[model samples]
Target: MSSDPRIRLSGVEHTFEGRSGRVQALDRIDLTIEPGEFVSVVGASGCGKTTLLRLIAGFVHASTGTVEVDGECGVVFQRPSLYPWLSVAGNVEFGLKMRRVPRKERRETARRYLDLVGLGEFADAAPYELSGGMQQRCQIARVLATEPPTVLMDEPFGALDALTRENLQAELRRIAKERTVLFVTHSVEEAVLLSTRVLVMSPRPGKIVLDLPIETDPAQDLDTLRTSPAVLAATEKVRDHVQRRTPLRQA
Candidate 1:
């Protein structure tokens, strides 16, 4: 792990107008993610998991505190967002093109990332032609094509069926191995399967209530890893904290 952090949040707070009055989504959110580390945030709904990602992505300003990001960021939203009119490679190439990369080099680089995501053959396919899983993978390749050192993912596989979600989880585990990843997910298994560390947040007006370190070699078989005693213990701990913070819902 690098001594320096790739992303840092200091006393971070965020609030915005809701149907009612201002809703305070996050409070005193102090966190640091080092280079090449996979960090996941898990919380109940309305706990500001998306708000946290927004803070880092600069989609909205924090009502208070500061978020510092060292390098460019690539984001994968809960809903797959791809250019329907563009082919797979065109979508991937779009990012580099925005950075003003040469046309020839952009296509080559986009193809490389497409290949990395196992979508090389579908480079010319339209987004609608692919399955939901394939489209999400294409979205990922598009992000990777931009070569962002820090990636913020807001439930990249949340909509997929269990089998497809699990499959993409494995794929993401592979692709995110060397990147600085901050993922917001509601699934404990997903968090355990992918993150080096998992932070459990309180209910709405969220803040880190528990930070659990996952112990398993990234190269280990995921099934075996999931069944590992360490993982169960950590999951139990995280779930316990979440349960304590959660009652019947009050948004």
Candidate 2:
């Protein structure tokens, strides 16, 4: 495997031109994400978290500086953008089919990923038939089916219920174990739990203000890890950065 960073941004800035005027989304951002790292970004609303993900995903161009990704990357957005008309299996296979993989090969690959996401039994079901969490799992399975080197997620689980969100977070950790991930979320705990490192972005014209590493062991049970001192401290540090609050000093 190559040792190069899977994603790199150098002095990157992005601005949106609107009827009112130009609005800057990102300002002079420099970031490097190495291969096989799970990095989560958090910030207040309109901090350009989504914009940064889009720039790396190539959905938009940076106004200045450079955005470089080592290879093809898959994206999972806030909504599960599945084809309602297609069966779960077909939705997963869609990307592979576009690449012209043989029908049987793509079908097998789709089934394999669906099984990975715990949706193997729902292969024939329409996307609408599944619950919200299942739909998101299908969306993830679709991305994994393509075998991309990097995955970019923009608040992918933000809409789900509390329990479902946590469940999906665990599933995501397993599913993305070996892949390079750039995840954006508003949940500080979620970021701390799932990321190898968490980055806090300043408000609009966003700049990364804090880059905090998570030292909790992934092997521990979720409950144990969640309550661990390391996890709590890391979460607090990220929360403080996002809220722009200083830690209390003790005598």
Largest TM-score belongs to which candidate?
2
Q: List where candidate 2 sits over 4 angstroms from the true fold.
A: 245-251
Question: Whole-model lDDT, candidate 1?
Answer: 0.88
lDDT per residue (tens digit) for residues 1-251 in model 1: 45689999999988899898998999888888889989999889989898899889999998899999998899999887999999999999998998899999999999898988889999999999999999999999999888889999999888999998987888888888779999999898889878899988898899888877777887787778888988888788777777786533221
lDDT of each: 0.88, 0.91
Error of 2 at 181 (Å): 0.3
In candidate 1, what residue range of length 10 has the lowest lDDT sum?
242-251
Q: Model 1 compared with the native: what TM-score?
A: 0.94
lDDT of 2 by residue, 1-251 (tens): 47998999999999999689999999889889999899999999999999999999998999999999999999999999999889999999999989999999999999999999899999999999999999999999999999999999999999999999988888998889889999999999999999998988888879888888777777886778898999998888888889983332211
TM-score of 2: 0.96
